[model samples]
Target: MTELLGIPPQLLFGQLLLGLINGSFYAVLSLGLAVIFGMLNVINFAHGALYMTGAFVAWLLLSYLGIPYWAALVLAPLVVGLLGILLERTMLSRLYKLDHLYGLLLTFGLALIIEGLFRNAYGVSGQPYPIPSWLQGGFNLGFMFLPVYRGWVVLASIVICFGTWFLIERTRLGSYLRAAVENPQLVRAFGINVPLMMTLTYGGAVALAGFAGVLAAPIYQVNPLMGQQMIIVVFAIVVIGGLGSIMGSIVTGLGVGVIEGLAKTFYPEGSATVVFVLMAIVLLLRPHGLFGRTRT
Candidate 1:
C-alpha cells in the first residue's frame, strides 16, 4: 500500500471521515449561532442547552412516548423553536436595547440552569440512542466502509446549510430580515412586523441547533453533557469563521473539522488546540473574518 507522508491511506481516510462528520455538526450549529448573532445581536450561550434539549426530546419521545425518529426529526426542532420564541418574547427581547453582552450573560445563565436541570433528572451517564433501522448499515466503497447514516448526515447538513444560505441571501423574506436587522424602525414603517420577524429568527436559529441535536443522538451517547462538550468547539469555530459571516461559519467549520482530524492522526496531543491555533492565525490575518463585510 502506498503511503503519503508516512500516513496510510486507510487511516488517513478514516480520520478524514471522522473530521467530516464532526464538521457536519459544527457547520449546522455554528450556522445557527451566526444567524442569531448577526440578526439579533445576541450571543446565545444557551444554544448548546437547546441542542441538548433536542436530543433529550427525541429520546423521550421514542422511549416513553413511542414517537419514531423521523417524526422526532420534524417535531423536536419545532418544539425547541417554539421555546426559543417564548424565550425571546419574555426574556431576550428585553435585552435588545441593552448592551449585547447582557444577552450573552443572560443566555449563559440559561445554559447553566438548563444543564443543571437535566443533570438532576438524568445524571451524568450517557444514554444510548439507537440508529434508525433503515440507515443501520455501511457501504463498501473501494477505499472505505462508509456508514450509510454518517454519509446521510454529511449530505443532509450540506443541503440544509446551503438551503439556509440561499434563503437568507436570495429570498425576499431574507431581504426583509436583513433590513430589519439593520433598521427595525425603517422596516416596521414599511408595515413589516419587525418584532414578529425577530421572534421567528430566534426560533429559526434554535431550530437549527435542535436539528443538529437530533442528528447527533444516533452517533453519540445522548447525554446532558453532549451539547456542552460540543458547544465550546463550536464557539471557537464561530470566532474563527468570523462572528457575522454565515458562509464563513459553514466553510470554516468543515475546514477546521478536517484539520482537527488530521492533527489527531499526526500529533494527537495537538488536536484539541489546533482549532484555537487556527483561530489565532485567522484573527491575525483577517480581523473581521474571511468573509465578513462591513454593513455600511
Candidate 2:
C-alpha cells in the first residue's frame, strides 16, 4: 500500500475528500452569515434552522410533490428564501434599531421554534435522499476512489463561492450592499431603498444556506438535526476567518476541513476537538480573526 508520511494514501486522500466536502458546506453557510452580518448587523443565529428548512423542503418536494432533485435544488431555496424574507419583515426588521443582541436572541428563539416543529413532525431519525442517477458512482484516482458526487460538490462550491465573492467585491450592486451596510441613511439619500435592500440581502443569505442544504442532501441523511452540528463548526470557521470577510470565511472553512481530515488520519481521537483548538489559537493571536477588519 502506498503511504504518505507513513500513513496510507488511501486513508489520507479519503479523509481529505471528506474534509473538502464538509468545508464546502461550511463555506456556503458561512457566506450567508457573513453577508447578513455585514449588511444587517445581525448575527442570525437562526441560520442553521433555515438550512434545515431548506433540506426539509427539498425532501418534502421529492416525497410529496414528486419533484426531481434538479428541480428541488432550485425550488427549495426559493421557498426557504421567501420564508427568510417573511421572518425578516415580520420580526427581524423590527429589531434592527434595537440592540444587536436582541436580534441574536430573536433569531435564536426562532431556531428553537423551527427545530422543534421539525422534530415534532419528523422525529429524530434521518431520512434518506437518493443520489441522482447521473452522479452515482466513484472514479479510481490512483491514490483513492473519488465519488463523482463529491467531486461535483467541490467544483460546484468553488464556483459558487467565487461567484458570490465577485458579486460582493466587484459589482455595483455589491457596492450598494456595502454602502447601505455601512451607512443606510447616506445610501438612501441617493434614492436607494435601503430597507428593501436589507430585506433582499437577508433573503439572499438565507437562500445561500438553502443552496448548500440542497447540495448536501444527497451526501448526508436529511434530518432535522443535520444543520445543528454543522452550524456550530461553521461558527468556529467564521470566527477563525473573521466576520464579514467573504474570502477569509471560504479559505478558513476549507483549511479547517483539511486540517480536521488530517487529524482524523493521524489521531482520530483528537479530530473532533481540533477545530475548536485552532479557533482558540486564532482568537488569541489575532483577536479579530485571520482576515477580519476593524469595523468603524
Candidate 3:
C-alpha cells in the first residue's frame, strides 16, 4: 500500500527485478560479442542464432536425453561452443584478411540459414522450460518477494561477468590472448599457436552466448525466434558500453538495465526507446563510446 515516487513498492521492485534479469542476459551476451570482436576483429552476426541454438540444445537434452537443467547448463554451452569452433575453422578463418563487412555478411547469412532451419523444424510457438525444482521458491526480502531463480540469475551473472573480466585482464593466458590480438606475429614468435588461440577464443566467446541462452531458457520460453528479439538490443548495449571493452560491457549492461527499469517505472511508454536514445546521445558526445578506448 505504501508508495515510493507515487508508485507501489511492489511495482517498482518488480520492474527493477525484471530489468536486472534482462540485464543479466544482456551482460553475458554482450560480453561474448565484445570478446569476439575484441580479439578476432569479427562481427558475429550469427551470435543470435548461436544463442538460439543453445536454448534448443538444452531443450532437446531435457526432452529426449532426460538431461536435467543443471547438466544442460554445462552441456549446452559446450555443445554450442564446439559447433562455434567448427564454424570458425571451416568458414570464418577464410575471411580474416577480408573486410570486416565480409565476415559480418557471412555470419549474417549463416544466421538466416540457422534460424530458418530451426523455424521449419520447430514452429514459431514457444516451448516452456520449467525451472529446476530446487530453485522454484521465492524469498521475502521485506519489501519484495524475490524468486530464487531470479536472484540466482543476478548473482551468477555478476560472478561470471567479473570472473571473465579477471580472466581476460589479469591472467597470463589472458595476456597472451591480448598480445595475440595486438600482434599475432610477435605472439607466434613466442611459440604461441596464434591461429589455434583464435579458434578457441571465438569458440569460448560463443560459449558465453550459449551459456546466457541456457540461463534464459527457464525465464523465457525456448523458442526459435528468441535470439532475434534480444540480439539487436544487446548489440546496442555492446556499442554503448564500448566495443571490445570487457569491463565496459559488463558494467554498462547492469547499469543500463537498471536505468531502463527505472524509465519503465516512471515513463512506461519510453522504456523501449530509451536505450537507443541514450545510444545517440553517447555517440554524439563520445564517438568511441563511453568506455571505448580511442586509438591514436
Candidate 4:
C-alpha cells in the first residue's frame, strides 16, 4: 500500500470521498438558504426541521405506503414543498413587512414545533432507510473503494446545484424573481404577480431543503434531531459563502466540507470545530462573507 504523508493512500482517499459527500449536502442545503434569504429577506430557521420532515416523509412513504425509494425522492419534496406553501400562506407571508427578527423567531418556533411533534410520534431513536437496490454496490478504485450510493450523491448534488444556478442566473422565471425582489412595485406594474412570486420562491427554497433531506435519508438515520445537527453546519457554510450569493454557497459548502475532511485526516481533534473556526476567520477578514457585497 502506498503511503502519502505517512497516511495510507486508501485512508486518505476514503476521507476525501467522505468529505465530498458531506460537501454535497452542504452545497444543496446552503443553496436553498441563499435563495430564501435573497428573495424573501427572511432567514428560515425552520429549514432544518423541514429537512427532517423530508426524510420522515420518505420513511413514511416507504414503511406504510410501500412506496419505493425512487418514487419517494420525487414525492417527498412535493409533499414538503406544499407544506411550505401552506406555511407561507398562513404564517410566513404575514412577516414580510415586519422586522426580519420576527421572521426568524417564527421560523425558530416552527422548528421547535415540528421537531417536538416528530419526537412525540417517533421518539428520539432514528429509523433505518434502506439503500435503493440499484445503488447497492461499490467500485474498487486503485486507491480506495467507492460506494455507488455515495458517488450517486455527489453526482446528483452537482447536477442539482449547477442546474439551480443556471435556472436562477440564466432563465426567464428567474429573471422575474430577481426583478420582483429588487422592485416589487415595478414588477407588479408590469402585470407580474410579485406576491405570488415570493410565495413560490419561498416554497421552492424549502423544497430544495426537502430534496436534500431525501438524498440524506438513506445515509443518515431518519430522526427528528437529524436536521438540528446538520443545520448549524449549514449556517456556518452560508456565512462562509455569503448570505445570498448562490454560487458562493455552492462553492463554499463544498470547499468547507473538503477542508473539514482534511482536518480529520491531519488533526482529528479539530475536525468538528474546523468549519466554525473558518467562519470566524472569514468574519474577521471579510465580514460580508466571501462573496457578499459590502454595504455603504
lDDT of 2 by residue, 177-287 (tens): 998888888999999999999999899899989988889888888888988878888889888999888988889888888898888988899999998999999999998
User: What TM-score would every model get versus the actual structure?
Assistant: 0.97, 0.97, 0.97, 0.98
- Tens digits of per-residue lDDT for model 1 on 1-296? 32747887878788989999999999999999999988998999999999999999999999999998999999999999999999999999999989878998999999999899999999989988899999999988777789999998999899999999999989999999999998888999999999899999999999999999999999998989988999999988998888968998999889989998889888999999999898888789987777776645
Q: For residue 77, what is the lDDT in candidate 1?
A: 96
CA error at residue 90 for candidate 2, angstroms:
0.6
Kindly provide the TM-score of model 1 when superposed on the true structure, using C-alpha atoms: 0.97
lDDT per residue (tens digit) for residues 175-195 in model 4: 999888788999999999888
When summed lDDT is taken over every stretch of 10 residues in candidate 4, the lowest stretch is: 1-10
Show model 4 residue runs off by greater than 4 Å: 1-4
Ranking by lDDT: 4, 1, 3, 2
Question: What are the clashing pairs of model 2?
Answer: none
Model 2 lowest lDDT segment of ten:
1-10
* lDDT to native, each model: 0.92, 0.90, 0.91, 0.92
Candidate 3 residue lDDT tens string, 1-296: 33636888988898999999988888998999999989998989999999999999999999999999999999999999999999999999999989899999999999999899999999999988999999999999888899999999999888989999999999999999999988899999989999999999999999988888888999999888999998888899889988998988998888789888988999999999888998899899988888899743
lDDT of 4: 0.92
Worst 10 residues of 3 by lDDT: 1-10
The TM-score, computed over Cα atoms with residue i paired to residue i, of candidate 3 is 0.97
The residue ranges of model 2 lying beyond 4 angstroms of the native Cα positions read: 1-5
Off by over 4 Å in 1: 1-4
